[model samples]
Target: MEIAAAIQRRGLLFVLSSPSGAGKSTIAQMLLSTDDGIAMSVSATTRPMRPGETDGVDYHFVTDAGFDRMVAGGEFLEWAHVFGHRYGTLKREVMKVIEGGRDVLLDIDWQGTQQLKQVDPDIVRVFILPPSTEELERRLRHRGTDSEEVIARRMDRAASEISHWAEYDYVLINNDAEKCRELVHNILKAERLKATRRVFLHDFVRGLIG
Candidate 1:
């Protein structure tokens, strides 16, 4: 049997953070479609569902009271107020996936990433930036889901979000979607092969030398 197949490896929490309409979500979908080992972390949110979003898939839509109760109960690994709405990741859901040796991909904002980092320092954080502010506004308008007011709000917030790029492990300029996706995929592959993450290799090396 191959060494990779025989050895047990631990999984990591892979995070993707970006300003709205900056291609983080698009790249996340691309990765999900191509990578079988990683799964999206469906966050619980108090925000209303959008046109094509599914209940449990896109987000776990919850009432404000329900979200408050979960927060009081310490159910979330990280929670943040985003765009006047509350969003959070359930601790149990993420723990189950990662403990089973499967990666969990998080599409969240900078605040949530900071909180998650406090909980798990081993997480891999990646930030995506648009090629230009004009291009970002264009992408927001192209989505056609948000109103003019919301788009304005997102544009206003983009500068603040982009300022936090220095905090991430890796930062990518998403000028070309395919190229950016390839870069993100390459980062995942390399992180998975990191020496610190491959602790089981110690035992394998001992066996070979003995």
Candidate 2:
């Protein structure tokens, strides 16, 4: 067998961050649909369930009191308040996925990414940027999901989000959605092949030499 196929590798946390309408969600959906080795890390939130969302699959929706209890118990790897809603990643669940050798994909904001890094510095961070602010506004309008006021708010917020692009390990311009997805996949593949992740490679090499 080839070295890539023979070596046992540890999994990693892959984080993707982008402002609204910058193609983050589209890329995330594409990756989840195409990649079997990676799975989305379901977040727990204190927000009410949306119309089409499922309980455990979309988010682990909880009451404010329940979320507070979890925070008090140190059950979260990272937690943040966004738009008056509390969102968090459960440490036990994410560690379980990583320990089982399956990469976890996180679609979170910059704040959550920073917190996750403090917890697990090995995470790979990628930020997507729109080609231009005007293009971003156009994409948001194309969606037709939000009101005029909401779109205006999102445009204002995008500026702040884009300022943190330098903090990510990799930054991609989302001018072409498909091309960007391909680049993201390539990054994941390369990260998976890194020598550090192949924990038993040295032993494998020794056995081969013997």
Candidate 3:
């Protein structure tokens, strides 16, 4: 009983992926709001700042030269260029949270997820899916942020994204917000108990023998 309470773990890197309108962001927000043990991963980017975005909270802004330096030094777990701007998962940033025995949540695409797994094979991956293509398109348009043309392009991109669903450890459809959130919460709970994550278990089990 004492061992159970004192069992320390090397925290998990929780990767959440989905097409643009599949509700992964909403689910991530719900988890962050309720769970104190998990924190979101703030990626570093070379993109210009937008209005009201904090330098460190939203992203760690860097210049092209600095980003190149980081890449050369082997500092990023994963890095990619999107439409000419560069973004990366900072090696130190993730370790700070994970070393403190807390989960790190990531909202990334399938390509980023693959790159992350290559660096840390212990990472837990989940993919969210929309109930239907029509529903996905409806949600995208209902937001009223993108034009019809953009929505059509996004729908096309969604098909390509969904093709990688099989790469994830868990795939769930976002048919209902409440249910979707609950399912993700449960998955995190299960992943936390995995044998590899519990480094203290070896000593705990050893004590049981004597």
Candidate 4:
């Protein structure tokens, strides 16, 4: 049998998207918390600050005029208007992080993922889904923050959002949080091993052969 080629490690751009109550953000947080080499992409938004939110942390809160200026300058890698608010990722920041030999993670919506893919097809897109509609409703209600009317609206929106799961490269069902996190971790590890991304591998192999 022929010997398999060894691969090299390379930085990656990871995009994780999901509907409300699907646990995408939770999983993303866990991954980042566990991996020091991965950086979360901070988005710029036109939405008002919620309780305990800080500018440049949760988001770079900006006025509509500022957002417009950034868009006109083509500074955003991807952006979308969601729930009547605009959110976007800065292209330069993400590039800088990846170029520094670290993986960058984007917690965005389906629209933003699509836009990112258009700009960089190498982005690894993963979609998270709740196990079931009943389970999703239960999780939403369990939050205890939303009123009944708000919860109902969220459940309705979740159905429409999850229908686009097929558009993602990987679909993860959040049945067990630990298992789901492992699945995402495996995907990231595998993507980093792809030959095209690991350009240094060829040189190392040539050195060994010589």
Clashes of each: 0, 0, 0, 0
TM-scores vs. true structure, each candidate: 0.96, 0.92, 0.88, 0.90
lDDT of 3 at 88: 89
**What local lDDT does model 3 show for residue 54?**
97
Candidate 3 lDDT, 117-143, residue by residue in tens: 988898889999999999999999887
User: Which candidate do you rate higher for TM-score, 1 or 2?
Assistant: 1
Q: Taking the tens digit of each residue's C-alpha lDDT, what string does model 1 give over 1-210?
A: 246732466788999999999999999999999998888888999999998899988999999999999999999999999899999999888987777667899999999999999998999999999999999999999999999999999999999999999999999999998899999999998998887888788877899999
lDDT for 43 (candidate 3): 88
Query: What would the per-residue lDDT of candidate 2 be over residues 91-159, giving only the tens digit for each residue?
Result: 877877777668999989999999999988999999999999999999999988778988988998888
Tens digits of per-residue lDDT for model 4 on 7-35? 23567789998887889888999999888
Q: Over the full model, what C-alpha lDDT does candidate 1 score relative to the true structure? A: 0.92
Superior by lDDT: candidate 1 or candidate 3:
1
Question: What's the lDDT for candidate 4?
Answer: 0.86
Q: Model 4 misses residue 93 by how many Å?
A: 2.2
Most accurate candidate by TM-score: 1
Please give the range of 10 consecutive residues that has the lowest summed lDDT in model 4.
1-10
- What local lDDT does model 1 show for residue 200? 81
Name the runs in model 3 displaced over 4 angstroms: 1-7, 47-52, 63-66
**What Cα-based lDDT does every candidate model obtain?**
0.92, 0.90, 0.87, 0.86
